[model samples]
Target: MPRATDAPPTATPADAGPAGGDHLGHGLRTRHLTMMGLGSAIGAGLFLGSGVGIATAGPAVLVSYAIAGVLVVLVMRMLAEMASALPASGSFSVYAERALGRWAGFTLGWVYWFTLIMVLGAEITGVARIVTGWLPGVPQWGVALVVVAVFAAANLAGVRKFGELEFWFALVKVAAIVVFLVLGVLLVLGLLPGTDPVGTTNLLGQGGFAPEGVGGVAAGLLVVVFAFGGIEIVTIAAAEARDPQRAVGRATRTILWRILLFYVGSVAIIVLVLPWDAPVLQEGPFVAVLDVAGLPGAARLMEAVVVIALLSAFNANVYATSRMVYSLAGRGDGPAVLRRVSRRDVPWVAVLVSVAFGVVAVGLNWALPDTLLGILLNAVGAALLVVWVLVAVAQLRLRPRLEAEARARGEELPLRMWGYPWLTWATLAALAGLVVLMLADGTARGQLLATAGLVAVVVGIYGVTALVRRRRAAA
Candidate 1:
């Protein structure tokens, strides 16, 4: 059990280049980090995807969201504890390397990178579809291509500029949700101009709150769990903040409660306002609520907001995937060329390579216009589960050492896990249960199998590469 400092350095001096160095720029501020987390977590999942959850479990979908929300809060706490102690662009991947081994780090890094890449494809495709609705003649793939290009350019500009753009994007999402929540509450209470009290009709009357029973709740959990995937970007961005430890601590603390409110609150409102079986739920839950509230042109307005949400998420995922690959390269797990940085302290090569899949997905949109998003979503659903499992394991193994080090230095840890070992273990068990649930459901089983295949491929590649390098050195 070697300590993090005792482990071999993930990056070496040789990795540094003349152009701004190999290191990522510390350009993110506390506000930027906080909003990026919000921007990432609140995207397609809530706006467009939650409808699937409601449809699956009826109002009992709240149970699914609550379960997922609690899991995210615990996982983020574990991640924040580790990130505050040892922040890096790789974030949990770096921690996994130290606490588990290089193999774990390599597998987690590559798996997470691929996961975000798939998510990038989904986000851009989602946005392109929404945009095409506004301009019927524009080709969806064309819009996807333009979006991929715009975000690529924005990411290449530098971290600060990227952070500023994400800040505003997330702000718009948060504001829209706030207004929606207020309107929902007013409408439910019969406070809106011409509306009567909706009462508990939607909640209790909707197939007795669990239309499909426990099986449906399980299915809903599978659908909604992935919504919490992007919140980890906060920990990743912490590496680039002016003060990683302080900024990460603050951001993680506030983000947990906010996410719960936004996700759980919004879902509750939707189910309370509209029938769980409403056909409009499939279209867009947020928009459906607004439309039912009698707001003029609510459909168009919310559709526009959803486009922004998808774009915001697309931008954040681009940043996350590029940094993950850049970190992987720096650590010798990926190609060394990805370590190259631009004059603005941006990982130019990694940014380009990361978005390359989005470009490919543009073609997929053109080819498989109807089914591309569902395919991508199902493929990547279980990836976050794997990543979170690793994060918890890494924290479990590292927390004791971190505490010992803090004690030796006569200081308290900047941020501590809420209930170490106990809560950490509980979170792991909950994640395992989610995996079991995924296996039980037919659709989720496919996603779990796909993610399993991806992880196996990554692990096999890493193992073979390591053996080759070892033999080469011996020869």
Candidate 2:
């Protein structure tokens, strides 16, 4: 394998922008890569947003998760192909640049960076709200401030330290969900204390399982699509992994099943243990299930879990946000200062900037209590979908070229994306459908606009850079 710096320079684009040719530090391990994947994929959304999906689709929400899960599986396969072929800190953004063109990469990279930063802000805000509930006199902003500082320090320590911290954080959430799943199965079997098996009747009895119909399922897909947003963090983390290609293969192969069990299994338990129409489902579905299961301390337990979820997301998002910025700078996509790495091999400058952005977002939320995090988060959500589409497009263009390269070198390509152009096309159509679905939802529509606006800003910057380069070349 060629060192990034040793790899031959790409044929310059007609308007050749700066090439991201630096070698990323090899600081991450196999374990870190695997756990980062878990940390990124499992978040508060599963614990919280599934409630929204259930409210919209009822029992049919399970189908929604299943459908979305299949789509993510396909996307991961595409991601794995590129990550294995060319492991880079920039992940799919680099693939987009190398495979498609410079502007495509630059746009997706910046868009993803913006999305993660806003998401980090939302995580801080979310954790603060939960913390305030436990400690009333403390202002929510104070808690959010403290949460961001602590996680930022942890991230600045180094990639290995960040991974170890995330491993335990991911472990707790994973264990709790597993316990919930076990208990749910028991309760459904009439084995749990003080409860009769609700039987399978609830699955079909209430609104015939598809009460809201296929459109309900389609609407549910909107929420489910957002749920998979964090999975791509695996690819970003892979660049530093001990053996990136293998780590990606392992994580990509296993992620879908874990998500299905954790999400679909947990939701299934919630529905079986309590009525799908239960009032608590409108608030927090997990709490609703635990309350009915006769847990003596369900609220306390859930509050603790939600706080952990928020903090875990906070830690992972900060790391992800900073790395994206560092990659951008390393690749000449942003300010040069962001490319500096500390003695610990951590990109501290990028880390501080990302944390500062999070702190500012927290302050805005505090000043405008009526305003929701959605305003800041909308562009991010839209950017996530766009990045995935870009990955699909990148693979569609690059895979054949890569295969040809491997054949010429007398090396068989290992681990290809499952289907060729057709499966790739199907995935794109699915993404297109999701974007349309998001547009139909009034709340999500604003996010689409903001995302479009953000992309436009990046494109404008690209145009300016191209013109400047052309003028200098002519001179």
Candidate 3:
């Protein structure tokens, strides 16, 4: 009943290959893929940070979001093109190795992994903020600890359960955004109870919409970049999808529209419905908008939604962080223990290690008080954008070889990145500029330092490992 070719390949310690163990189970489906994409894209950024961006850029923040949205779409397209070509558990890390070199893979994988763990810290801190608002008596440290334990346990349950949980978590977020958007649209059209038709005057009325001028827009771009950090998780999750290529392709194609509608659409409505100078934006934009509508139970509703949003982020980060570790282990870049999979087809060691690190972040949030979690948040954004640049470069390097291979095999590539070499280069250049900008600004310098320090550490480890291997070989 079995063919020799059907047997799974065995892995060895010296081989940078995925270990044999129930195959990590391709348990994700199209629905899971879709919701995961939505879940990754929608986060606390929209609810919390949009107000900051709007304040910085005035009405031009809409333009800033649009610009950032395009960049994310392009990056996702580049990642999808690569993922479709060789769908693997290692995701962009594998793409970098195959396209560039072992160094590229080692560096980018750790950087991405670092970003995820740092976000794990930030997510717990964020949840604590919302929680403290509800129960003023509770300490931030205790709340963060409770949130981490709950979400990490959710992640250890296995991919299917994680996907199912995120599906509902994503649904709650999507529903909130949709309801907000509908209310915004209705309010603008003078359709809501006791509300008049708001004209476009709000767009230009608040000090001509560019009160802070071009400099403000540039400053606002930092936060705009952060808003897009989580969008790349879809690529990581795609490797586990039933039809990885199709899922990635479908998700990429539709993701642009979703970002436009949920992010751009919602912000546009907020600017139109309320004055740009509203004090509520200082507190919280999403909360402010609902309170403005004078809806009964709006504050409680928003607090609940924000809590769900934070939990969803924690869940996703743990999943992303563990998968990153599992991938690094599979490729010989991390601890061998991380490569071990459990009966549930989950990477148990990797998950626990990631959770342990998350717990540390929680502890830091409580004890340190004057920590770099806030700075690392910005650094994580820069690092993620840097990862995007690496993915784009990797694709540029590998596309020709991939095309040649397909042509030799008499098969055409079904999905190809549009405008190939030049567009890819432009994306890289744009990311480089962002990094340089971050370096030049006093506020953004911390992000550059964190990202550079992390990169250096990974590179050092890689070099040290290589030296050890060379000495052993000579021995």
Model 3 has an lDDT value of 0.78
Per-residue lDDT of candidate 2, residues 267-385 (tens digit):
88876666667678878887777777789888889879888887888788888778777776766667777766676777778889998998797787689544556565554657778
State candidate 1's TM-score. 0.95
Ranking by lDDT: 1, 2, 3
Cα lDDT, all candidates = 0.87, 0.78, 0.78
Q: Could you say which candidate leads in lDDT? A: 1
Give the higher-lDDT candidate: 1 or 3. 1
| Candidate 3 C-alpha lDDT tens digits along 1-475 | 0111111144343222234562466778777777777877788788878998888788888878887887787788888887776676667887888888778888888888888887888878877877887898998888888887887778777788899999999999999999999998888888888888889888989788777787777777876776866767777777777777677778777766887789999899888877877878867888777776878888788778878887888888788888877777766677777877776777778788989997897778778644545754765746876688788988899899878877887876657888998888888887887777677778778767877788988899999997986899799
lDDT of 1 by residue, 269-317 (tens): 9999999999999988988888878899888888888889999989998
TM-score winner, 1 or 2: 1
Clashing residue pair totals per candidate (backbone < 3 A): 0, 0, 0
Q: Stretches of candidate 1 above 4 Å error?
A: 1-11, 18-20
Give the backbone clash total of model 1: 0
